[model samples]
Target: MIVGIDLGTTNSLVAVWRDEAPQLVPNVLGSVLTPSVVGLDDQGQVLVGQAARERLQTHPQLTAALFKRHMGSAQEIALGKRKFRPEELSALVLRSLKEDVERAFGEPVEEAVISVPAYFSDAQRKATRIAGELAGLKVEKLVNEPTAAALAYGVHQKDKETSFLVFDLGGGTFDVSILELFEGVMEVRASAGDNFLGGEDFDTALIQHFVSSQRQDKHFPDVNVPGMRNRLRCEAERVRHALGQQPTATFSLAQGGRQWELAISQDDLQHVSASLLERLRGPVERALRDARIRVADLNEVLLVGGTTRMPLIRKLATTLFGRFPAMHINPDEVVALGAAVQAALKQRAAALEEVVLTDVCPYTLGIETVEQFGRVLESGHYLPIIERNCVVPVSRVKTIQTLHDNQTHVLVKVFQGESRLVKDNIALGELSIPVPARPAGEVELDVRFTYDNNGILEAEVKVPASGEMHHLVIENNPGVLAPQEVRQRLAALAQLKVHPRDQMVNTTLVARLERLYQEHLGEVREMLGNMAGSFQQALASQDVECIAQMRESIAHRLDELERSPWQ
Candidate 1:
């Protein structure tokens, strides 16, 4: 089986290739969406998905959902005496996905091409690939989510010259990808996104709205209270959904010995959400700016995600681009569908010939030069030599003269970002090029950057005078692991004993939990069943609650089940 996983920050989903069709694997609950959350059981067992998410709502400090945002950071979250890197935690999610897909197909599936946001950094991208390895999956390819969505949407349109912008508002990340479809080839010109923004922002906006409503309308104290944050978030999401169509919607919460209700207007929501919307403007503008296509030139705008259902988003996108976005596939499924389509193509050679795609580096990639001047001489500058929207299978060369006299070695620090300062950009790696000892401006150096179909950046610094050249690859990044270290670690990882304690307990635990929730579905409904039924179903079926309904239901039951092991 070939699988496609959208390893999102807030949610993780698994899709499989079956008989030429990409089918989403429904969890035990018979649903597709899974919450990317995990918690620990009383017996030091790992819990994943919905149950894990529920633990976050009831036990906020213990469970984590948006760890994907912390991928490149030096942070750690400990659970049950085990310290986990973000990559490890993410690996567990992928492991669970692998397990569920195997159960659905009753076949072994090893290779997968997971999707990532277009704006992921080199460190982040490497970390993501590592997470895949830890989960025991061979990453066939890593495709950007927005570009995947473009493939799905582009195929439906017969217009040979259509250009579109894919506005993807996911659970924890937001991306805008501009693509042009020509002669069955979908080429991505520019992609931009905010890893920190998404449906969560709207939740924050709703929180602020409620905070004000409490202060003025109901005259309650500040909105902070035990369990109140979760209630506020839930109601905020509710109000956001309802206000999308209705002029107003009611939001009510019970906390601190009181029940508060709010009838929020759409205008109020748009106002409260203005700050969040303002943040999106930069990404949108940057994507279009890089694509070099005017909003007026775009034939259509493709909207992806449940959040795009918001009236403000459609309004803003239409206002900015002069065209209302099109939603051919379910916004929630467009990216996943695109992923499935790609996975299918990968399995069959015949399909590969029919499908051709071009994707670009979502952010600017540069190298730090001498001094604190942060000169990005290669592919990063005021005007990139290759240009953002240029056709791919392309190489661009930058010429730099020797800065100092008798400089034999030049240190080039490659970075990635749109920031104007060195401190603001991501330092990808460094390269040292040897030149014939010469005076200032005597030697000519050519820095060639070649980006291929996979979005992999290969750079070589050449000294024409001395005929010396040095090259750098993502894995060859200094101080990370010098190839030899990785081999040693993998050798070490083989003997590390990752607690493969047989599924005797895992199976029993899974079956018992499934049986309990299957019998009394309300345990999930009232607890997490508050969300859509299909979403909740996925939660109830996992060793971890991977959905809201599943999280709440499983966490509640687990709590009750924990109080009496003898029962």
Candidate 2:
């Protein structure tokens, strides 16, 4: 009765607990995917999923797909008269998914376990919870997408205690996770990802290719259109998707009303995306450095997301890791399945308590200070306050001598990133590690970093001699705007009738959700029948109130199902 949903930045998906396993549901289009799109029809009614996505090619002005990128930001996109905020738009996507699940079962769905990126901050995670609430289904658990994927792979066909890395490259975000599969338990040892990277970068690479190929093509062409840039961007995306396995893809684009056809080989597409592909190495390398391990030590490199289907990605991964990556679980649907299992466990629906998943904070959180060389202490130095891949139920304490003799209080600047320079990184927040005046190196500043089952970081600094203690989380956090702020700006942005953009989370969300829905139709249908018999009849009898009531009832059932479906 309960399903797991992966609300990705470029796409979305829904799956359910089944026969002691997780299965994805498919949409009505006979594909295990539905685009995460929404648009006003010609008649002013709203259309979502595949239909909304189709409108993108022609009705680019009205449709909005891939709004997930703006999740933690204060960006607001306008569609029509309604100035829907990101959370509201996200809720609409979840609502559409709810309807899809209902159609699959002819009953109402009430509960769900949703998956989000492991690196999502508290604000982003909270926003996701609210989106689930607005959709009328209870959120059983907010499982991290990477961790879920790990569980989906690690939980069954089980493994002994061993460490493996998960390379998750979706359409909008990329995450590298190291996990320890131990005695039926899946624990995240460390995680790092780039929110701005993924399949979208590949599209940009291809766009660069097209622009380069046209360097001197003077075949009656100025190559300009009011929306030429956007059109080329769309075409580039199409080509990237087509070149997944095919040796070649031929795409003709009409830019500025002038048509140009390019016969792109896989090699050509690969070359275009080479730079973007190159960018992934930094994060992957940084993560390994943080984990203090080489790729050769990994037991397996599991790939997650649709983009992993590409040949070059696989080749690059094999080249870097010196081993072939594992595949079988649908890259798009695995996260959703793992989410469902997590939901079931959270609700106590399954006897999986022995299964423990410990995830690490993706970003290094610390206070800023200057080095003797006039260097600044930055967040991404890879000198983790708590090193990545250190086993859980662990805490580390470090002490440093005060630099100044007369310092009464020390100012602390916290940051997140892999950069060495303070100016080149993100400031998480600021703090003052209090200390009494003393000669240089006379006072010891004690700092402790502790990590729980979840990877959230909390810092405690002690001026032991003065009995002064500073307890706080990481600082300099501008990564995610507050929810109220995102909402307020989103409402205002709605009035301008700004064009809906494809940020990409919606694209991945659609693909993932559709795949999940199709895999778990049988259980979903039976639950729908049991939850809304009268409503099903009303749907047939044209009774609005009964249908609405049944809808509410189905949602409640889903909520219950989400808490613990197997139980």
> TM-scores of all models?
0.78, 0.72
lDDT of each: 0.69, 0.67
> What's model 2's overall lDDT?
0.67
Per-prediction tally of clashes: 18, 54
Per-model C-alpha RMSD? 7.6, 11.2
- Best-fitting candidate, scored by lDDT: 1
Superposed by TM-score, candidate 1 places the C-alpha of residue 137 at a distance from the truth, in angstroms, of: 1.2
Model 2, 347-380: lDDT tens digits are 5656565677666666554445545534643332
